[model samples]
Target: MPFAVYVLGLAVFAQGTSEFMLSGLVSGIAEDLQVSIPAAGLLTSAFAVGMVVGAPLMALFSRTWPRRRALLIFLTVFVAAHVVGALTPGYEVLLATRIVGALANAGFWAVALVAAVSMVEPAARARATSVVVGGVTVACVVGVPAGALLGEHLGWRSAFWAVALVSVPALLAIVTSVPDDRPRVTAPTGASVAGTGTPTVRAELRSLTGRRVLLTLLTMALVQGATFGAFSYLEPLATRVTGLGAGWVPALLALFGVGSLVGVTVSGRVADARRSAFVLAGMVSLMVGWIALALGAVSPAAVVALVFVQGMLAFGTGSAMISQVFHLAPGAPTLGGSFAAAAFNIGAAAGPWLGGLTIDAGLGFRSPVWVSAVLMGLALIVAGVIRLVRSPQFTKATVA
Candidate 1:
């Protein structure tokens, strides 16, 4: 990967940490701001809503700017929002700050993706994108946990301050390292088959709405919803079900993050070397099994193992689906990637709500795991159907 991609990864790492750190500090924030836990929870929901609202809006508005400039602008916005988040005094102000931060987060990822892809050769695009997104995986493994620990020891506001501190270096690295050239379209020829069309933004949106692309987005949404629906409440589950102490929950989460890091790294290679659709199908299937095991297994060791596996399968497939979106909608990879990101947040928002309902209704903590398994199964079926539809005729040369 180019050095520029690593800079983008740092930006992504900072963004991801800022975005997810709130989850681990909900109790601390509630106590510090004199708000109810549920209200503190709105911090997460507000961010998700902002991403959903901002993804397409930013993509549409920044269509004409050079991708690098767009990235820098959004990263600046992100850093400013984190500053606001760090300095806010009241719950309402903090909530508003998160909203701004979420918008910047959504816009940054959308633009950074285009910038990353534009920097690499066609054959290297998937790997380059993977390296950029690996920042998110790393955040899951390290940043979130570290922020949570900081918040636990120093106060919740300290976590936001740490995020802000990281943003300065990330911004400097991006501005100094990333090239500022606009994306140029080259005509496709024998040596350059990947450079195809220079479609207008409107035409790009139209093409992206095809059935295959829609199915891919749905698959992404379902898998994300299922995973978050169960995963968000994992700490409570660990305490209530396994009788583990509160201190160990973060360690377990770190394990899950380790699995995610492994998954994202491996999945990138799989997407590059194999058919993305096939890889997506297999990963979703693996996720279903992992969720099932996590729900039904009584042993704590088994639960931890299954959670790690769930993380691995859930994130491993992410690269494949992202690559598929770019391939299916080559005319507007940024918009498509943004839409996928939005779908992910949409699922993130929905999953917790549904899981809360299940818990409120006296369903066991494991019920959400079962629910997630069913949803993942549905996603797997959708993936299989999409693959079959895309290739209805199985030639004797390859099959049977």
Candidate 2:
């Protein structure tokens, strides 16, 4: 991996920390801002929404700019948003800050993925993506826990301040390490590859409509929805269903993160080569994992083990599939990144919302796990269809 990819991962670590750290600070934010806990939780939803909306727009607007410049711009705005979030006096202001920060985060993610892949050989797309996604895995393992601990001791605002502080170095490193974008036709030869040198929005949008690209996005959304749907409620499942004490939640989360780190690392090595098999196997494993959680919720040990496995399967599968999106889309790197980001965030937002709905409908916590399984089943069916439809055109288009 390039040193620049590592630096991009560092930037992702800081941004991702802010994304997941909100769970721990919800109570503090609710109490301090005179809002209900549910309202405080909306802050997370707002970020998700921002990501879904901002990604495509940001990518579209920044398409013509150099990748490094776009990255720096996004990080700067992200840092500013964190600073404002820390200093906000009211819930609404804080909410606005979260949205702003999310927009920046989404933009950074959109551009960074394109940048990282462009820096490597076609064969290394999955490995490069894993390096980037690994940052989020690390954030889950270390940054979030540390942020929550920081909030617990110093106050919730401290976590925001810490995110901003950590982001500064990432911004600086990106400025120094990342190179200017060079002319490279991202599309396959003889195709109507958009953005050969200076890509037009119309051309980019056209490229995104390819069947392979659309299918990839749909699969991404479904898989993420299933993953987050179950993940959002893991704490409740652990405490209420599994009979674990409240203190066990953090450990469970860490275990999940560790599993994610392992999964992404391992999958990165071979996903690109055995792309179809990797996806098929991962989706199947994930479906089984979710069903196991639903059936085994009563056993603390089983639930604990399943959480780690599910985390691994979810992230590892996502890393592999995401690499395919760029190659599959052909010629619209920024737009493809935008769509990927939007698809993932749509799932991120929808998963928890759907999970909450199931809980509110008096379907036990296990219902969400079942929901996860169903989503994975849908994804598996889609992946199967995608595999079945692979023609010579498909092979030709994706042949780097």
Candidate 3:
């Protein structure tokens, strides 16, 4: 509820908008650049790669700076990267700009959660982190759709210009609102200062390596892979399976976004009140079931309903997973959190690629949904095993 949280959220909003708007504008970018759609799609892949490479690198390098100062530096980089992206003359140049932007993004999120936790009391940590991540949820629900409309109506370039324009205010907000508190703990002996050395980050990573965190992250990767695999080809699926025209695709995506927003908001409260792992596991199980039903359903209405449900379960579990990591590694939360973020993006990259292969193999759009279901089922088994391993008796008495 602090003013600083809102400012951090705004920064996150700008970053999320920039990151996700590409999917909606891919065709526009391809046409304008006179390149194939697949080629334009590489822009997205480039960004994901940037995040994977940047998250740990930035965290390691920034390990020594004060949390507030580190965030400001990253936000400045984020804004500058967007400005460059908006003005770039060629596709290669634009791709470079996106990569820089993605790196800035990885650093921004990594520090934001650490900063947020430091700012609030223990009981308020989940809610505060939720507010920061809420920006991404809002981006999916509103920002991406609006940017897509702007790109379609004006031009793809106009969308980046708009992002650049928004970045100005976001930068100013971060500069003025973020506190000047130094991180309470020092970095590890060999680690960088801005990197995760806080008690939370360390504890979470230790827990992550344990049965519970490992299974939780594995479940997350599997569920996200399956969901995004089908979701990446949603337009085709909507067309082929639901018999809908091209015009309805954006609306359906918006509906899914709405589900994600609701799920993310609800998950925080659930994790705060109940067992985080239990909530995560339940959501993952439900998501798998929904995917199967959506794939089999004959009616467009049924498919739409299931899509909404999928969004809810996917992101709801996401919120729980993040909070669980923080709990497990309360000493060094950001490293664990960043690793999880990396896992999510890795899944993001893999899902579309896998889905494309299935489509190319003549398996039809629905086949990806089945693939996702299988992945989710695997995640469920992983989660159940972790639960068994972490049971009270097991915790008190080790099997080894």
Candidate 4:
């Protein structure tokens, strides 16, 4: 409901475009830098690795700072990274810039999530989270595609410049709109602690060690790994396996993004009350969708429709899992978000690597679909165990 939440989402859109637009620009970058295509793709992996390491580290480092100040620092670094990346003459410099940008992006998301949830009432937490995560869905739909188009027409560096330009307005918005952190609380002994109610780093980390919190983080990782694994190879799957022309690749990607938009929006409405059931159903449906896609890869119609379906299910599950992390670890808001961010990025990194391994092993593109299905199946088992453990009957039996 607060305007600052939307501004954070605006910031996410800019950074997320940079995160995904590399998929479209890899070829151009490879050619321009005289690097192999596979070498160019490592840029994406570098960003993912940075996010996995940065979220918690950045959150811990900035935990004592005012939220507004931390956000400004992160976004400013992100914009500057893009500018430097755009002007880089060699692949090594560009790769370093991507890692730097991802670190900033991860920090922004970690803090922004905590800030967004703090601004809203408990009952509206899921809705508030969706508003933040919605930026990624929108970026997938609009920003990445537009970035790709810009790279196609104006060279890849121009796409980088565009992300920097778009982020400037978000930087200005944060300055004007986002509130500074509240004052710290003083204990009876006159020691000051964070206003966030958590007093120490050890306590913050301890809160995340609970069974529910750890499981929720794992579920997030599995769902994301499954989604990205299949998604990373959709192009080859479409052109080679599904027999679609290269021109249809963008359309398929757009369709998947549209489905993600719808999925996250719908999940937000009901996730506050039905987070467990929603995630379970989503993973189940997503597994089935992947299985279907694998079986019917020869049919172009099936591949197209199934990609949309899987996108909806995957993103919907992802958004719900994020809120679930907050709900599970109520004592460590920022750290919980950081843990979720780290989990998702870990999956984002692992998925493509595993998918690539399957391809390099001479498994066809359809093999990635099967890999996604297997990941989702494992995720479903995790979600099911959580659901079972939390059931009223199970608790009563455990007490006995």
Instruction: Give the per-residue lDDT digits (tens) of candidate 1, residues 148-262.
Output: 8899899888888888888788788877888876544333321113444345666667767877888888888888888788778888888888777898788878887888777
For each candidate in turn, the TM-score is 0.91, 0.94, 0.90, 0.94
What's the lDDT for residue 97 in model 1?
Answer: 85
Which window of 10 residues has the lowest lDDT sum in candidate 2?
Answer: 183-192
Please identify model 4 stretches exceeding 4 Å from their true place: 183-196, 391-400
Residues 1-400, model 2: lDDT tens digits: 8899999999999988999899999999999999999999999889888999999989877877889889999999999999998988989899999999999999999999999998899899999999998999999999999999999999999999999999888888888889987444343333344444634566677788877688888999999999999998998898888899999999999999999999999888989898878988999999999999999999988988898999999999998888878878766766777888899888888887888899999998888999999999998888876875587776777784
Cα displacement (Å) at residue 391, model 1:
3.5
lDDT per residue (tens digit) for residues 1-400 in model 3: 6888877887888888888899889998888778899889889888989987787677756755776788878888877777777677688888888899899889888788777766787677667767777788788878899899899899888888787777678677767787776544444333234543454345435555777666776766776787687777778878878788888887888788777778777775666667565565655666556566555655788778877877777777766666666776544555665766777777777777887888889988777777777677777777778778879888778854
Tell me the lDDT of model 1 at 296.
58
lDDT of each: 0.78, 0.88, 0.74, 0.88
Q: Which regions in candidate 1 have their CA more than 4 angstroms from the true location?
A: 184-198, 392-400
The total of clashing pairs for model 4 equals 0
Per-residue lDDT of 114-168 in model 4, one digit per residue for the tens?
Answer: 9998899988888888888889988999999999999999999999999999999
**Which order, best to worst by TM-score?**
4, 2, 1, 3
TM-score computed on alpha carbons, candidate 1: 0.91
**lDDT score at residue 301, model 3, on the 0-100 scale:** 82
